[model samples]
Target chain A: MTIDWNAFTPWSALAGGALIGLASALLLLANGRIAGISGILGGLLARQAGETSWRLAFTVGLLAIPSLWLLFAQLPPIHIEAGYPVLVAAGLLVGIGTRYGSGCTSGHGVCGLSRLSPRSLVATLCFMGAGFATVFAVRHLLGA
Target chain B: MNKTTITAFAAGLVFGLGLLLSGMANPEKVLAFLDLAGNWDPSLALVMAGAIAVGLPVFTWAKGRQKSLLDEPLKIPTSNDIDRPLVVGSLLFGAGWGLAGFCPGPAVVATGAGELKAVVFTLAMLVGMTAFQALQRQPQPA
Candidate 1:
């Protein structure tokens, strides 16, 4: 397969990855919590008392930060190749799958792997393998 | 807000910024990375490596601590059993990710950016999660 040399941004990717690592680390050190997005958001739906505040605060911060960044740097252009129906289907799968799996890229891929959790490794491999397979199927076989 | 809340908020901000800078928020970029057959972009691999590099040391240090800085009991997941749900669920999540190139974190962040598609996707995801919770609460046929 050909590599997209023009679109590649290794430095930015590395820098951003470092920031994510720092964020998860800080959360663990200070709050004693895993920075798993699904867990954080899911907790809000369950509405457990004493847990609501931190989850809400984190959600607010997540939403607010990017908006604030627009004042300084223009966000890169967004292009979604899927239609509304596809997006909806994909979103549903992600939400339910993350909850059932108990983690996502952040929880399992970032935090779990960092701690060398075997479960996270399996989950990461499963999801990543599935991701690769799906892309291959959709873009190649189905040609969507 | 208390220190705990402030810290959580700060962590979220940093996480969001990381997503933006890493181009994870951009579906095209993510899709390109996922595309193994044509025009593959390995930039995301570097992102993961960078994150793991920093994370390995911190997690090691955290493991030695009994309590967090806020005096809360450290709550790391201790489950080692790889069950069917974990594998099936992850497979589904990955397929969805490949289909749309948007995961939970990026979708939520995209919604905040007021992308109409993101808003729709977020709503659908919440509905999906709610459905899962609802179904999970239902009695199983014996």
Candidate 2:
């Protein structure tokens, strides 16, 4: 398989990843919480968890990022490949799956792996394997 | 806002910024990374490694602690049992990710940027989550 050399951006990827770690670290060290975005957002739906204030605050911050970034520099361009139907279906799967699994990429992938949780490792493997398989099916087999 | 809330807000900001900067917010970039047979972009692997590298030490330290610096209880999950639900759910999540290349964090961030497709995905995701919640609230068969 040929490598996509033009798309490589190791430095920025590393830096941005470090920033994510920093964010997770800050949440853990300061607030004693996992920076699991899905968990945070899902908790809001429940509401009886009594962690509304912090969750809302975190969400507000996320929603405010574009406006905030525009002040400093233009945010990088985002390209979505899926049409509305695929996006909706995919979104449904992600939303339902994350809740059922108890974490998403952030929770299980980065933080769970870091914490040396076997469950997270298994979860990560399952998801990653599924991801690879799905892509192979879509791009190669189905040829969509 | 309390310190915890403020700290959470700050973390959210950093996390969103990181997603944007790491190119994870761009579904096309993510899809390229996922495309193993086609032209592969290995940047995502580096991103995960970089994140885990920085996270490892901090989490190791946090794992030993009971309370955070802010005096809040450390909220690490203690469940070690690998269940069917976990595996199934994770596979589903991955399928969705591979299908759309937009996960929760990046999707929300993109929605914030007023991307119309992102808006659709985010809304659909919320509906999906709400559907899950509804299912969860239903009475189980005795």
Candidate 3:
């Protein structure tokens, strides 16, 4: 596969991954909780009073990061091959998967795996493998 | 206040930086890789490789540490069962990734990347996360 040299941004990617890994490590040290998005967000949905505040704050903070960045940097352009319906459906599916999986990629794939949770390992493998397969099918099989 | 939250936030910051660096926060770049026919980019593989390289060492170190901030040993799942949840969840996640070219990490990172489409994807993904929780309220067979 040919790469567009102009579009490459490996430095940013490294910085981002390092940031995520560091965050996961420090959060464990500081709060003693896994920073899995699904778990955090799910706790809010269940309306578990005291837990909701931090979760909300965490999520809000997540949204805030981008806003904060906009102060100094230019935002990237966006393009989607899928339609609104497809986008919505895909989101819904992800939501359902998170519930069933009991964690999103952050929690299971990143935090869970880091902690050496077999569940997270399986879940990460499952999700990542699925991702590889789905991309293959969509791009190669259906050519969508 | 809690150690976990502190660590999580830190990890997220780094993760966001990684996304920014990898060009993963960009939908067009991700789509190109998925394109397979057009100019396919494999830059993401390098990002994964870098992450694993760092992660492997960190994880090994953490494994040897006796007590964590939680006052207990790090919890690692022992089961290797490949159950329905694993299969179904993976399929769903992959499907979403393929269709949207956005996963949760980059969707969040995209906010910083300043992409309108990523914003939309992130909002929808949040809604979807919420919807799943709502649905789970019903008593369904485990």
Q: Candidate 2's residue-wise lDDT over A3-119, tens digit each?
A: 999999999999989989989999899988888888888888888565898888878878888889999999898988788899999999999999889888899999999999999
* lDDT tens readout by residue for model 1, A38-132: 88988888888888888888888788877889999998666778899999999999989998999999999999999999999999999999999
Pick out the ten consecutive residues of candidate 3 chain B with the lowest summed lDDT.
Answer: B3-12
List where candidate 1 sits over 4 angstroms from the true fold: B140-142
| TM-score against truth, every candidate | 0.97, 0.98, 0.78
Tell me which of candidates 2 and 3 scores higher on lDDT: 2
* Candidate 2 residue-wise lDDT, B23-141, digit = tens: 98899889889898999998988778888999999999988899999999998999999998899989999999999999899999999999999999988888888889889899999
Interface RMSD of each candidate, angstroms, one decimal: 0.8, 0.9, 3.4
lDDT of 3 by residue, B44-74 (tens): 6565555555555666666665566656445
Deviation of model 3 at A12, angstroms? 2.9
- TM-score for the A-chain in each candidate structure: 0.97, 0.96, 0.88
Model 2: residue A122 alpha-carbon error in angstroms? 0.8
Residues A1-144, candidate 3: write the lDDT tens digits.
Answer: 566777666666555556666655554554445567667666767788656555665565565566666677855544666677777776667766776777766777666666567777777777766666677777778876
The number of clashing residue pairs in model 3 is 38
Candidate 2 structure, TM-score to reference: 0.98
lDDT of 1 by residue, B12-98 (tens): 899988988999888988999999998899999888888899999999899888899899779899899999999999999999899
**Total clashes in model 2, counting residue pairs 3 or more apart in sequence or in different chains:** 0
